[model samples]
Target: MIRIQHLSLMRGTKPLFEDADLTLNPGERIGLIGANGAGKSTLFALLRSELHADGGDVDFPSAWRVAHVAQETPALERSALDYAIDGDATLRRLQVELEEAEAHPDHAAQGHRIGELHAALADADAYTVRSRAETLLTGLGFSQQQMNRPVSSFSGGWRMRLNLAQALMCPSDLLLLDEPTNHLDLDAILWLEDWLKRYPGTLVVISHDRDFLDGVVNVIVHIDDRKLKRYSGNYSSFERQRAAQMVLTQAMIEKQTRERAHLQSFIDRFKAKATKARQAQSRMKALARMEETAPLRAAAEFSFEFREPASAPNPLLVLEAVNAGYRVEDEATGASTERTIVKHINFSLQTGQRIGLLGVNGAGKSTLIKTIATELDPLSGVARFGKGLVIGYFAQHQVEMLRHDESPLWHLAKLAPDVREQDLRNFLGSFNFPGEMATSSIAPFSGGEKARLALALIVWQRPNLLLLDEPTNHLDLETREALTDALAQFDGTLVLVSHDRHLLRATTDTFLIVADGKLMPFDGDLDDYRDWLFKTRLSPAKETQAAATANAAPSAPQVDRREQKRIEAEERQRLSTLKKPIESRIKKLEERMGKLQARKAEIDAKLAEPAIYESANKDELKTLIAEQGACGRELEEVEMAWLEQQEALEQIA
Candidate 1:
């Protein structure tokens, strides 16, 4: 259990928490939520002991091991797998000690030390550490081949995933995750949800994703009014509870206002008269003694709408046999090469259609959106835009394109130079930029602020078509809700690619799955998409390819039923034939491991007896220790072989 008592914290003179108290019970999955700059991350830093509270008592069990994702991963030449496995500090320490003990010259003196190290390794389950690390990496969307690659080779986003894997690999009693899903796709997010659900530790995550919070957390700790308010149940439950509290608070405020007015009226009427002077004086004292009920300081409300387009044309855009991808350049030859990411795409956008793109990361959802936005021309096909068509595109790069030295007012004015500065400021205010913020330089703004400014610029355009790719990235829950509401009410056609399930479900009426260089309509909703992802993961690559190809072209020639069955049978037989020897090898290894483990246990039991330590039994102790060391080594070798065989079986599938 963790207890925070009279917690008072400050960043400069800004008080984030004043006499705040919270109790976190063991095994409780908590979601820490607050407005931007509300010190959620600061609280995490305090928990990690990276920051000290101004005045507070933060107490937890001293024996507890804490784990958190590192904010920055230094570029290194270490293999991704090795880096992740290093999270198991205990296992690594034991292995290092074992190596040192074995390298000692005197076998008699080192025998006891070697035996102890092996026993510690077995207790830590060190033999399976590699498999555990690999599993974590795989769940975070790393391929087997990629797991062996140098950590420095990955991009920033991928490195973040590696850091997440490393954190999850640690055997921790308390796990702190700050925006763990930011770099993850929907599939990986779903996978993580399951993993965290099964974790036997206390988890506290800070995230802006409502759906993720709803899926993973059982309690919500809201930072509001310089206090930590704990709410029972998930995010939706927290919203309901908070809403009810706000209503009650407002009612109390109104009631107190009426009472104050009544007291003032009585006091003013009689204070000048001698007859009621005593009563008036007493009433004045009562009013002064009354505890004030402060008015509710509501969060800044963010709301905006898309301006109606000048024209709404049927079939706003059309793509025929389009091959959408990037043009790569060979550095040595200085020659550009076209690489199609999404091929044979036949898609159209009509007025008022809301479509969401679904796929794993690197499945070309961005490519399709880019192709439609005209950020990239189709490699080889026709992409026609209707007359009077206007597109409002929002991507991460678009946010980066904002002039850092300019204010929100200036950015809006650039789009509408004829509009008055006040009117433009009003528009920016709707997106939460008011007063000095509208005129101040955005150089020091956070990512969420920049993203909001970019979106504000888009809403001002009133485009007939909206193409948003991961627009919710770096956005808080409030802004995301605002975007969802605005998109829901927008009359223009929309194609959105976001991992935010709540926004997708609320705004998109249809979903298109992008996989295997093909895009096709999914008949079901997000839940079905999740099931499809799991099934696809379990399926063989060739089968997945075949399914994608069949879905892409409805008119493709189909194999006869008998021929298809025959081919499948033959494929199954071949897979089984290849797996037989590996499976046999794995069974033999398991048996060997079991026997060695049993023998080691017997040796341990004998070693625990007092007689084994007697001078007369010194030689017996040495013999037993040597046997124990040999057993541990054989067991480790057998486990590795078993893991290899399992991988081979997976490859055959």
Candidate 2:
């Protein structure tokens, strides 16, 4: 549990939290929400002990283990699996001790130490830790081969996934995750949601994805006006509760205003009258000391609409047997090759159709979107557009192309030189860049600000077709909601590739999946897509191996029935008899290991109780500790036997 008392924090001169108090119990999953710059990150920093409260205390039990994802990972030569398993500090320590003890075989004390180290490793289930780490990598879309590769071989986004896996590997009482899904694909996001639900520890997640919050968190903590307020339920519940509270807050302000007016009136009437002077001064002091209730400030209003196109295109674009990807040519041999990512994709969009592209990280969603946007050419077939079709493409990289020295006003004017300045300014206001912000250089702007300017420039072009890929990556909750509303009202054709489930549910009418080097229509909603992903993707490694074996297996010619039956029966009987003993031993060992694990877990729960370590119960505590050690040693012996048996079984094959 954590306790915060009269906490006040300042970021430079700006007050983030003033006199805020909070209590967070163990095993609570909380979604920390606020507008950008509302101090959510600051609060997390305070808990992480990177920052100190300005006025009061933030306290937690010293025994509580805290875990958080590393913001940066330097390129390292260590294998990804080894790096992930390094998160378990206790396991690593025991492993080092065991190695040293085994090396010093002449020492009697070292022999005893080796047994203790092995027992400790067994208690942590060290033998299966690699499998657990591999599962995390797979859930985050890493191939099995990648798990064994050096961490330096992965790109930035993949490195972030490795960091997340490492954090999840650590055993902790409290876990702090900040924007965990920012670099994830839809499949990874869904996997993370399920993982968090099963995490039996306190979780504080900072995210703006509404649907994700509703699925994983049971509580919402919002930061507003330099105060922290805890809501009773999830993000949706917090929204509803905050809206009602705003209304009530405004009503209280009005009542406070009336009371102030009444007090001033009495003071004015009684002042300068000898008999009433004393009462007048008292009333004056009372009026001065009374605190005025601040009026509620409504959320900022941001709205925009796509401009009408110069010409209407009934069918915005069409793909006919298109192979979308990179085209390579060999100059020396005069040979050409096309590395097709999405092959034989055929689709067409009407003027107002809204389509959402869904797939795993490397399943070609982005490649298909780039091809549709004309950034890449089709390798084999036609990608035809309707007459007078104009495209507005917004990929994540588009924000980086803005001229650093230019402002929003300058960029819009360059697109439409003849437009009136007032109209341009008004349009910029709709994207929340008003007056001076539109005129000032955007070199120092945040990612969200740059993204808004890019969209504003696109809308000003009156594009009839739009292609967006991960447009909500850097957007805050308010901006994401604003973008969702704007897209919902868009009259032009839209094609979006995003991990945001809320935006997909609200804006897209059709779902297309780019998978297995093909683009196909998917008849389902986001929920159905999630179900499909889990069902089909849970055992990707097995499927790949099976497919490989199927392709490589030898084909036998037709033979006499008696000959085939005789050969098959002999092989079956031989393999069964050879493998039975090893298999039986493995099964018995596994059963014994399971019972030992259950007993260990029961002891762990009892050990966690504070009263178990009291003076009166010291003997009981010592006995329990000895029992736990015995169980660990037994489990270790069973695991060793099981492994040897499994090896023998594999040899029989």
Number of the top candidate by lDDT?
A: 1
User: Candidate 2 residues 464-520, lDDT tens each?
Assistant: 888999988878888888889989988788999999999998999999998888898
TM-score per candidate, chains pooled: 0.81, 0.80
Model 2 regions lying over 4 Å from their true place? 105-109, 266-286, 328-336, 417-426, 439-441, 539-653
Superposed by TM-score, candidate 1 places the C-alpha of residue 64 at a distance from the truth, in angstroms, of: 0.9
**Residue-level error in angstroms, candidate 2, position 278:** 6.1
Local accuracy of candidate 1 as per-residue lDDT tens digits, 19-100:
9999999998999999988989998898899999899888889899999999899899999999999888888889999998
- List clash counts for every candidate, in order: 0, 0
Which prediction has the highest TM-score against the true structure? 1
Off by over 4 Å in 1: 272-275, 417-422, 538-653
Model 2 scores a C-alpha lDDT of 0.84
Model 1 earns a TM-score of 0.81
| Residue-level error in angstroms, candidate 2, position 447 | 2.1
Q: Model 2: number of clashes?
A: 0
